[model samples]
Target: MSDRAPQPVERRLPTEESRQLVALVRDIVSKEIAPRAAEEEEAGRFPREVFTLLSESGLLGLPYGSDHGGGDQPYEVYLQVLEELAAARLTVGLGVSVHSLACHALAGYGTDEQRAAHLTEMLSGGLLGAYCLSEPASGSDAASLRTKAVRDGDDWVITGTKAWITHGGIADFCTVLARTGVEGPRGITAFLVPGDAEGLNAALPEKKMGMKGSPTAQLHFDGVRVGDDRRIGEEGQGFAIALSALDSGRLGIAACAIGVAQAALDEAVAYATDRRQFGRPIADFQGLRFMLADMATQIEAGRALYLEAARLRDAGEPFSRQAAMAKLFCTDAAMRVTTDAVQVLGGYGYTQDFPVERLMREAKVLQIVEGTNQIQRMVIARHLAGPETR
Candidate 1:
């Protein structure tokens, strides 16, 4: 690889503050995150301290309200920060995204009392959060989830398991969805449960192909009880809340995918310029040069796509369709670009000595999480042509 440091990405920020925010993120990444990423990831160790630092630095709550201990920045700016963090380490970037997702219900649907009670600590107090919506059987068809929340006077008892939870065992709080009425989506209700609540237990984290540093596990709620005050929105409104959170969460994923892709491209470019083939650098070859060009182009396009969606969100316009499209396109592009980066490195790319292989594995999950690309396409189609009839 080239000895020179990789140049910072050029960004269009609406204000000098946002530009400075990006610079701060980069400084933290260089000093704290990037250096230890490969080692910690290889050891399957999550860097919780880094998250604490991020929280203290006001990086954890950028897209939320300033009154609630958030930065009140636009989604456009928040997502770019995600991209920078992901470039340094996917674990940190995606962990931040999941934390924001976990905070969504309370921020958007909670009463003033609820926000006052918990939002600030959750946002900037170094407390981590997790979102619980998927069950083992209800990954894609979330409306059919079977977790039940039975009424116990002024309290509710939740019973069932949530699958594929990020930060499952470590989160300080979880925004959980459980069935509270009849079957299907309308039956669900959202509740903010303390992670250490009685009867709330986490399984061992899943063994994954990538992002091993970030835990993904199942949480079992065995009659976990919370007061009615913990309920987020109207009774039986959890599904809507979940879907709304996902519209923004998908954009976060899109940004992160581009970050991983960009990192892979940078590695490949550096290696190509430095590795001699025959009598000259491999980067000078026509075929490899074209591949590098395509990788850069795809990364740029994905960045633009996600930024446009973020802008729509910032403007308070309907952005769900664009969000779905961005999620779909950007993740696919990440997979492609990372794979091609591997090719550009020849046999060396397959080894753990380089980061591209890990990036490739991490990119695969982006297409599956939040909602699968298939789900994203269906969402877009529903927006374009309405829901399909059986």
Candidate 2:
């Protein structure tokens, strides 16, 4: 609602490098990404160059080991960068998060030779990645996935379709989970599959309600062949690797949610201050003022929740339950904040001329991505009351 740019959020950082990193990210967002976000998104154009820019800036490898070419920043720092990007443009923020998710399996579980050979390229050599886990029939019921990978000689043949992949068609590589043995979770195995490998095909991107700048598609791995050397961790360990990655990925989603919510609040406040009704500024009214107050409070709370979880992760402590709570609260908060932002703008917010409408649409996906808020609550419940028996 103010003509001035939203001030940078106050963040407590552990090091000078992180402080500088956040400043650099804000500069890039204001100059390069934010300007084109509305136009590119309306055209459904993906910002491939932005990813290149992020890669070159060393942002793509932030939470990884320096030995493997990462920036070696803590998860707290990495997620704040993601939040800054998401506020400017959610497509870039979410894309970066998904790329990090895609890299998690190999970075954490692959052999030394695998790390030396592929991790450098994935982390620092300007390549993009995707994570494959959900399937046509297994969205929340991931352990029941039907994708099969049969062993043959030193290579494995993979055949299955992965649904709702963020960078499905365009990723340079994919960290895939496929069934290699028994029927449940233990049957699964993780692999690093090249995007152009034989029999790997991505379907047309799905038409979405918002965040059109980012493509979502289904990938078909039809007997795709990958060498055994690409296998990550041991047989029957894929599900664990996938879940571990998700704990971190959920944090990413939470940060992005806060960013979107922040953006919406900014827009609402700016509009309210400038727009006048009945001979006075709408922001002068207590009703709108209270709404804005609530929105800002929720955003701050969500940010604190996610950052707390991230710190737990950086400490190498158990944080799955906290991660789930952050994901649940942040995303739901985004949804609520964005919806209220639209109401704050009244008729103007409902129209495409305002970014609030788009922000509202984009916020919906945050609730669904990584894991749905409903699923997040389920995970939290599991942690609190133990697992549910069928």
The most accurate candidate by lDDT is 1
Once superposed on the true structure, which residue ranges of model 2 sit more than 4 Å away at CA?
Answer: none
In lDDT terms, how accurate is model 1? 0.96
lDDT tens readout by residue for model 1, 1-390: 689567789999999999999999999999999999999999999999999999999999999999999999999999999999999999999999999999999999999999999999999999999999999999999999999999999999999999999999999999999999998889999999999999999999999999999999999999999999999999999999999999999999999999999999999988999999799999999999999999999999999999999999999999999999999999999999999999999899999999999999999999999999999999999999999999
Kindly give the stretch of ten consecutive residues in candidate 1 with the minimal lDDT sum.
1-10
| TM, every model | 0.99, 0.99
Clashing pairs in 2: 1-269, 1-270, 1-271, 2-270
Q: Which pairs clash (backbone N, Cα, C closer than 3 Å) in model 1?
A: none
lDDT of 2 at 19: 97
- Identify the runs in model 1 with alpha carbons over 4 angstroms from their true place: none
